[model samples]
Each structure stands twice: as C-alpha cells, then as structure tokens.
Target: MEIREDDLTGQQIIALLREHLENMHEITPPGSVHALDLERLRSREITFWTAWEGDDLLGCGALKELDPTSGEIKSMRTPAAHRRRGIASKLLEHIIEVARQRGYTHLYLETGAFPAFAPARALYQRYGFEYRGPFGDYADDPNSTFMVKTLVG
Candidate 1:
C-alpha cells in the first residue's frame, strides 16, 4: 500500500472519510462525536494523509499540531472493507514516525470509550499510548478515552 499526503480534494479519500463520519454518528452519541467533515479538514489547521492501494483507499489519519512540541492524532479511520489488513496500523505508524521526526515530543489522541472503539483502543495500546486525563480543551468526559505517547528521543 502507498500512503500519500492528500488534500481533501482527493475523491477516494473524501469518500472514505465521509463513510467514517457517517458511521461514527451511528456508534456514538450525536453530541459526543468528534468526527470531522470535509470542510473542517479542508482548513489549514491539520496535516492529513490517506493510505491507498492503487485506486483503493485503505484508510486515513491526520496530525494536528497542538503546540510547539505536541501533536494530536486526528481522524483515524480504516475503511470497513479494508479492516484487518494492517491499513490502519500502517497509517498510524507513518503518522507517529512523521511526528517524531518533526520534533513532536508527545503525541496524544481522543477516541470513544464505547465497545465500538475496542479495536482502536487496542491499536493505540500496541503503540505504547497510555491512558491520561483530559488534555487541551477537553473536560472529564466519560464518553471519551484520552491517551498520550511520549516521543522523546
């Protein structure tokens, strides 16, 4: 699979992202869902990437700079048809590597705490992200599981 940095204009990537957002609305309560839409991603606030295999979109993820030495993982989603093929894993690894090389001292993320998020929780655990209290503007939200990984050299 080839992972490429993409603008929100890429049709395959947009479709894959739209699918993820639509599905999240089903698994998560409306007010608590943090999924991003195409216009939101089109902003200059974050750097996004899409993992692809030829014409097939495998998955996508993004890194949002939180501060000088910190970044947050955003919009991590694997296409339903591409699950269990290591597409999410590859995209995550790529994000972490890029974040570290870019001088980010810590990487953090927020995901659902429901059963629907088990696979994603496991994926983050495998990468050494430990549970943490709410960061950024986040409060003590029972619906959210906050995690962080130190990327210090």
Candidate 2:
C-alpha cells in the first residue's frame, strides 16, 4: 500500500474521516471525544495522509504540530473493512518519522479509555508511547487516555 499526503478533497477520505468522527462519538462520551472533523483537520497546523492500494483508499491519519518541539497525532482510522491490515500502523510510523524529521522532541496522542479503544491503545504502546497525564489544552478527563513518546535523535 502507498501512503500519500492528502489534500482532503477526495470523497473516499472525506467519508473515512466522517466515519471516524461518528465512531469516536459513538464510543466516547460527548465532552471526552477529541476526534477532529473535516474542518478542524484542515487547519494549517495539521498534515493529513491517506493509505491507498491503487484505487482503493485503505485508511488515513494526521499529524498536528502543537508547537515547535512537539506534535499530536490526530484522526487515525482504518475503515471497518480494512481493519487489521496494518494500514493504521503504517500511517502511524510515517507520522512519527515526519515528527522526528521536523525536530519534534515528543509525540503525543489522546484516545478513549473505553474497551473499544483497547486496540488503538495497544498500537500506540507498541510504538513506545507511554501513558501520561493530559497535555496541551487537555484537562483531566476520566474517559480520556493520554500518551506521549519522547523522540530520540
């Protein structure tokens, strides 16, 4: 599969992000759901990417620059039909490499505390991210699981 920087204009990616938001809301509490919508993901601070197998869009993820020295992983999702294919893992690895290239000292992400999010939490853990308290603008929320990884040169 090939992963490319996406402009977020294609119908497949739009739908994928919509599904991601819907699923996040379905599983997480209202105030604790931190997934970004299409508009929010379009911010100048965010770089979005999509994984494709020729004509098929497999999944998508984004990296948002929180500051000069840190970044946040956002909107990581693989469609229901494409789960377990390592699409999420590839996108995550790409994002982390980009963060390292940009000189980011740390990479942070916030996912749900629910059982539905266990797979996601496991994925992050495998990448060396450790559970941490809230960072950036986040507050202490019982439904949120925050994680951070300090990048090495």
Candidate 3:
C-alpha cells in the first residue's frame, strides 16, 4: 500500500470524506460531532493524505497543526470494504511520523465515546496514545474522548 499527501481533488477522496462526515453524524450527538468537512480539511493548517493500493483507495487521515509544537489528528477513515486490513493503522503511523518530522512535540485527537468508536480508541492506545482531558478549543464533553501522544522527549 502507498500512503502519500493528497490535495483532496480526486472524486474518490471527496466521496470518502463525505462518508466520514456522514458516519460521524450518525454516531455522535448533534453538538458533539467534530469531523471536519471538506472545506475545513482543506484549510491551510491541515495536511491530508490517502492510503492507496495500486489504484484502489484504502483509507485517509490528516494532521492539523494546532501550533508549532502540536497537532490534532483529523478525518481518519477506512472504508467498510477496507476495514480490518490495517489500513487505518498504516495511515495513523504515517501521520504520526509526519508530525514528528514537522517538529511537533505532541499529537492529540478527539474521537467518539460511543461503542462504535471502541476500535479506533484501541488503535490509538496501541500506538502509545493515552487518554487525556480536552485540549485546544474543546471543552468538557461526555460524548468525546480525548487522547494524546508525545512525539518528542
């Protein structure tokens, strides 16, 4: 599988992002859904990437610079057909590596607190992320689970 920076111009990427938005809305409460829309993902602060196998898109993830030394993981999605094949894991690894390369001292992400988000929480935990309280513009929200990983000593 190949993971590379994406400009989010492809139809496939757009569709996948749309699906991600839909899924987030379906699972999270109205005020708690934090998934970035296409416009938000394209912001200057965010770097987006997609995982591909030959011509097939496996998944996508993004790193959003919250400040010079920190970032927030966003828009991580692996289509249902590509689930359980380590696609999301690979994408997450790539995002973390890129964050380190960019001199980010830390990375944080907020995911749903629902059962549907268990697998994702597990994936982050496996990668050394620990549960944390809300950061950035986020406040206390029972529907969200915040996690963090230090990228620098």
Candidate 4:
C-alpha cells in the first residue's frame, strides 16, 4: 500500500472522513465525540495521510501538532472492508515516525471508552501508549479514554 500526505480534497477521502464522523457519533456520546470535522482536520496544525492500494483507498490518519514538543493523533480509520489488513497500523507507525522527526517528545490521543472502541484502544496500547488523564483542552469524561506515549530517541 502507498501511504502519503493527503490534501483532503478527494471525494474518496471526504467520503471516508464523513463515514468516520458518522461512526464516531453513532458509538460515542455527543459531547465525548472528539473527532474533528473536515474543516478542523484542514487546519494548519494538522497533517493528514491516506493509505491506498492502486485505485483503492484503504484508510487514513492524521497528526496534529499540539505544541512544540507534543502532538495528537487524529482521524485514524480503516474501512470495514479493509479491516485487519495492517492499514491502520501502517498509518499509525507513519504518524509516530513523523512525530519523532518533528522532535515531538510525546504523542497523545483520545478515543471512545465504549466497548466498540476496544480494538482501537488495543492498537494504541500495542504501540506503547499508556492510559493517561485528560490533556490539552480535554476534561475528565467517562466516555473518553485518553492515552499518551513518551517518545524516546
């Protein structure tokens, strides 16, 4: 699969992101759904990427620079048809490497606390992220699970 920076203008990506938001809303509570919309993801602080296999769009993820030494992972999703194909893992590894390259000392993310999010939580755990209290603008919410990873050189 080819993974590269995306401009978020393609129909496929727009559709995928829409689906991502819809899924988030379906599974997460209204206030606890922290997933960004298309406009938010287009902000200057964020870098988005998509995974592709020829004409097929496999998945997408993004890294958002929170400060000089920290970043947040966002919009990580793989279509149902493409699950368990390592697309999410590849995108995650890519984001982590980019964060390291940018001199970020920590990577943070917030996901749902529901059972529907167990797989996602497991994936982050496998990548060395540990459960943490809320960070950034986040508050303590039972519907949210916050995690952070200390980047070591």
lDDT of each: 0.90, 0.94, 0.95, 0.96
> Quick one: ranking by TM-score, best first?
4, 3, 2, 1
Residue range 19-94, candidate 1, lDDT tens digits? 8888889888867888778888766769999987888888899998898899999999887788999888999999
Cand. 3 TM to true fold: 0.98
Query: What residue runs in model 1 are displaced by over 4 Å at the alpha carbon?
Result: none
Worst 10 residues of 3 by lDDT: 20-29
Question: By lDDT, is 2 or 4 better?
Answer: 4
lDDT of 4 by residue, 1-153 (tens): 999999999999999999999999988878889999999999999999999999999999999999999999999999999999888999999999999999999999999999999999999999999999999999999999999999975
Candidate 4 residue 74 Cα shift, in angstroms, is 0.4
| Higher-ranked by lDDT: 3 or 4 | 4
Tens-place lDDT per residue, model 3, 38-71, is: 9999999999999999989999999999999999
Using all chains and alpha carbons, the TM-scores for the candidates as numbered come to 0.96, 0.98, 0.98, 0.98
Off by over 4 Å in 3: none
The candidate 4 region of ten consecutive residues with least summed lDDT is 24-33
Whose lDDT is greatest here?
A: 4
